[model samples]
Target: MGVYGRRRCFAVLGLATALAVGALSPAAASTGAGHGAVPAGLLERATVVDLQTAMHARLLTSEQVTRGYLDRIERLNPRLNAVVRVNPDAIAMARRSDAHRRARGARGPLEGIPVLLKENMNTADRQGTTAGATALLGAQPAEDAFLVSRLRAAGAVILGKANQSEWSNFRGSDLVDGWSAVGGQTHNPYVLDRSASGSSSGSAASAAAGLAAVAIGTDTDGSVVYPASATSTVGIRPTLGLVSRTGIVPITSRHDTPGPLARTVTDAALTLWAIQGADPADPDTAAAAGTLPSDPRTVLRRDALRGKRIGLWREGHVGVDADVDRVFDAAVRRLRDLGATVVEGADVPDLGEVTTEHMLPAVLTEFKHDLNAYLGATPGRHPRNLRELIDFYDRHPDGHDHLLFDMADKTDGDLSAPAYRAHREAATGAARRAIDDPLVRHRLDAIVTPTSLPAPVIGRERDSAPFAKTTTHAAAAGYPHITVPAGYAANGLPLGLSFIGTRSSDAHLIGYAYAFEQATNARQTPRYLPTTR
Candidate 1:
């Protein structure tokens, strides 16, 4: 027996003993081994390209790669709680990939690669699209999400779903970012006790920990970028409509888009290439038909930063921790060294005011309307509307259903309210103006900022400081945002630098991110430390 056998035995025995003595807390029980270590070479920090090369060289079969990742998840997921479910048919899927390679060669760049989807994405398979809610645990969509279908066509194995914040954190404002009734809480891989910022918490954590080659996540606001920053991974929130949102459990149609989170910018770009296209099911995607480049990978270049004008946007935001600030400064210096013309103190005036005053109301209204539409279409004996969902929680046998937060407020709203219409109109104009004006007036290719403050400690304080100020402008404007690992803080937690560009500028943004990622090479494989000291 190797590491896998030994670790499995230890976990099973440890969990059994803990339960026998009535000493296991819910968190401890969910995290079985108490340590998030994985054996070296099992699935440690390997990129999708690396895996593809190995598979094509006949050194490893897709089945072997798939098994290795499954083994890694089994050993480490109990502690990280990143992946809630493992596909029972993953090995079978891999076998099919191997067969295809043998009979017809690789189907696409992603052929045979194992990937995890955020739980909100519908798979139309054994896995459920619950969005981490117990109420929808048995519900399944009649078809795969458009993005999921794209991944399948590119020969990706649907390994399973990563856990997400319940209802993509729309359940209530008071709930912790990663806590879900069905999947427990996702822990940051670098420090188990810190928050894995959601609602794409598991996707970021799993990608960081090498649980999969790549993972897909949904970003309505900072969900994708925030968690990626926290976990030291690359997350690309593509331009709105760049990737179809059809079949996803919605928070808001206005901002919702499925994006790729990966260990490297190239990997993320490849995933984006696979998923970006027109989908008749999502009318928004019609705008993206000719907007995307022929190939995103073609834009990846070491010289991508040369002669580019990048603006450092820092105005109208509370500052980051001193360590994070240092990291951001260093990143700026590196960009300048790479021949980029950096503009200082690039301000998006009234960004925060506009987003706060206009964006929130629009999101609230759209969340109620879009979610009701999705729930009505999903199959199963589940709540068909927001009102019924709130009632379900109220009557839950688990008296602790509302212990963290209540969803009663979301149940009372409808989209036709005049106040909501006004907010939507104002938000649309303000967001577009705030984002577009800066790029146009400054003649800048992209804007850069620290993605977030360091991840906060996970607990019941219910009033954690906001950490995503840098992300809100781009999120509200439906622009492309790419977050690359910047550096670790003094306490060893990760931080990220974000690259934001105008709408439909995904390829250019990716080029800048790829250049910065190549130059800094800041990301480090997580050590799974118990805590930051």
Candidate 2:
């Protein structure tokens, strides 16, 4: 996952402020395994499928499940800073879900499940959509974001908003991944002092700690998958148009798309199924017309990797930490054992050019336009345009980074500008070629790489350390990217393996990821250590 900060430093997308399912229905999730009282530690590691089965079997009530999550958040969030706010009406929503389940049946897989949303996603309710910046504090959205509305319709309990990188880490130079002026810092659950690679910091951390059943996060580049990798959870960055962007804070309309972070591939797929569809508000979603499956439950299979040709992007693994390399080597062997033909040396050609050129200018140009429109339409007294936003940040400079915001404000905010249009076109073309060329040449079903170096320590030391990531091509191409727990570093930090597929191949990638996840069973519940020993 390439962060937006320090993109210039690495020439490979860094976050220096810029730069960058299916599913079974609720009824089908049960394998008849649930009985009696909610299993011990259910809230800590229960999959959405597990919860649905328990609720369907009358072993657990939605309110009880909701309460379980609330209790955990109450006890753990102060230290993790993962959940920024709790919905006062969470129980009420859960109770309503219970009443519905009683009167009829489960609304869907997400019915009554508590979900944490990245704070940038607008929720027209008690929770604030601050995007982790004081500038937007108390800025109530006029309505739920398109995805949020879909989740609510599917009967999900809006548990609360998870903290995130301020302005999705787009406001400053040398931005810290999980630190926000409004929410403070979110600690990685596994190793508190380690970075929970963000801007979706809180969502991935919360999902890792089971603070909620699952979480929603936006990815312009590495935002979603990076943190999920850092926290050893599942994160899917869908093909851009598969999920609507309406109601979420903007980064670049070109690449920003909200997706799921969950503990299991199954949960991630189910969450995607619940919230994905075409929306008139987001014209990009027009491409999703026939892309989504009616039932993602059928998409998952234990043998999905069998007889498939998988390519290893070893360029992503070279010059990494030895421990991470060892883990990735083992993961490659495991893929082979599971019947996938592992094609070595399948690196995306011309990656340096893809990374160094086109992206930043296009992103900055679009951010100016999109944020102005979003703020103008939003119901708040906050700055309604880019200049005003820059001025707001300038007035309150303490602990804030506004260099990137200032850069964006200087732009004319015109998508039709020749310079902006040229960069946008070239960026997408290069990115698409980087991913598609390798697949066709190798006859590969998908490409695999290490999602990221295990979460780096938080602070100055990380600046000099290499930030290995593999999300850029997928992000820029507007294709599908999914990360799953692969192994752990010696200090107990989580490692993730990523699967990248061509555009609109989300279901196929999910199936492959699920197969690998089941084969390895590599994920271990976080122990909440104060630091890596």
Candidate 3:
């Protein structure tokens, strides 16, 4: 960057920090799961499936449904900032879809569901996708991204795009989890001061807040699961190839996956189906058939968890939040009460074997290639290339298109260097080695762990947030993992337990998750402002 640019960054940050600290300003409402109360209107309203039923019965119009979510975001999102850009045309789009519904029965299982997608995902509509950065503010793809096509085919109302950590948090080190240029920092609903783990921060917050029935998020490492757990919601990270990544903002293709976030497992499972399917454009997803289920996702067998053999792998990087552990313990007992064969053991497949030695260069190279391909093929407005995107950020220092990890990023030397080449091989090797094989050797249906190390800690440093240490294992393995609220901590924050399995075990994992969720009805609506002890 030029000398003047460097000086300006320091100036901007100085002002932003000062503002962030001196704020005790009260808003009319809050949706930050980290520190605010759950909106009553959303909870009292219909669930995701209920929206479908209403549409089918002619009780609600798709346009009306879309308008409702938009209204909710408008009424409540300012306090949480979970939704960065409201789709100004959402109601119009919904009206068009409503015309289809009137002519035919609902087109897909998700018909009329108002769903929020991470801004990184491309859509054919005029909606802009910047990955929560100011750099690509004007970049709206002409054609829908792969998964977006599926969502549209499913008749979902693409409500609005959510905020995420800038560039999926790959821009630099020392990044805050939920700070996005477009949306600002998303506050956790349960505790306002706690971090809203990113880079899918807005997805998690939006789902937990009841702004939408379900929201979609992407994970490179704990991006979805960690944030879902932190915010007391169900978020699933399907096996790597289970969902298409064709038009998503890039991080590492090897670990990136688009998943669903919802208040309940059924809602999440439904959204998952809508997004899954092989995309010829994305070769990685060609193998999706083996990993995803064709079964309808909204159906739940409440007794599915009963009489099942479940392996509890309690040893991971879980920070053992006192409130979280208490919740987990109760959940385990509920499992037993429900007639599940539960085994608690700590022989998780790998810890030291896969991590110490690593390969990341391979992943970064793929990221550049895959991202470039999407950018080139995308029809609408967007950065012509990654290099141009970086340049744009340089020209516009606005937070709207910026999630700053490092001002030094613009100065990083040539990525074409041999050192960069070697780095890719090392990181890929480590990821492949550390993930999957262990689950295979264990021969388990699903491996379970506390989804996160700690309950959301108010004002905790982003560096301390558990993502790689807790989630990268499953991510690297290319396996399916789901998080369900096990119970609430004494502090009233939610604690989550994760269900992970090998690549093709998505169905089994969901079935198991459903069973557990039924056995332990631990999720409770947040009261917005709980009295702190």
Question: What are the per-residue Cα lDDT tens digits for candidate 3 across 162-190?
Answer: 98887788775545788876778887777
- Alpha-carbon runs more than 4 Å astray in model 1: 1-39, 316-319, 350-353, 397-419, 460-468
Candidate 3's C-alpha lDDT?
0.68
**TM-scores for every predicted model:** 0.89, 0.92, 0.82
RMSD to truth, every model = 9.0, 9.7, 12.3
Candidate of highest lDDT? 2
Candidate 3 error regions (>4 Å): 1-45, 297-299, 317-319, 349-357, 374-442, 454-459, 463-468, 530-533
Off by over 4 Å in 2: 1-40, 353-357, 460-464
Q: Report the candidate with higher TM-score, 1 versus 3.
A: 1
Among the numbered candidates, top TM-score falls to 2
**Each prediction's whole-model lDDT (CA):** 0.81, 0.84, 0.68
- Among all windows of 10 consecutive residues in model 2, the one with the lowest summed lDDT is 11-20
User: Sort by TM-score, best first: what order?
Assistant: 2, 1, 3
Candidate 2 per-residue C-alpha lDDT over 1-533 given as tens digits, one digit per residue, 9 for 90 to 100: 01111123211111111111111123322322222223336678667876776566654677777877888998899989999999999989988898888888887889899999999999888788889988898587989999999999999999999999888988888768898887889999998988888899999999999999999999998999999999999999999889999999998999999999999998999899889999998999997766777878667888999999999987746666887798889999999999999999788764575455678888989999999999989997798888988888778777656888888877888999999889899999998998999999999999998888878787542563475458888888999999999999898999999999999889999999999999999999988898765
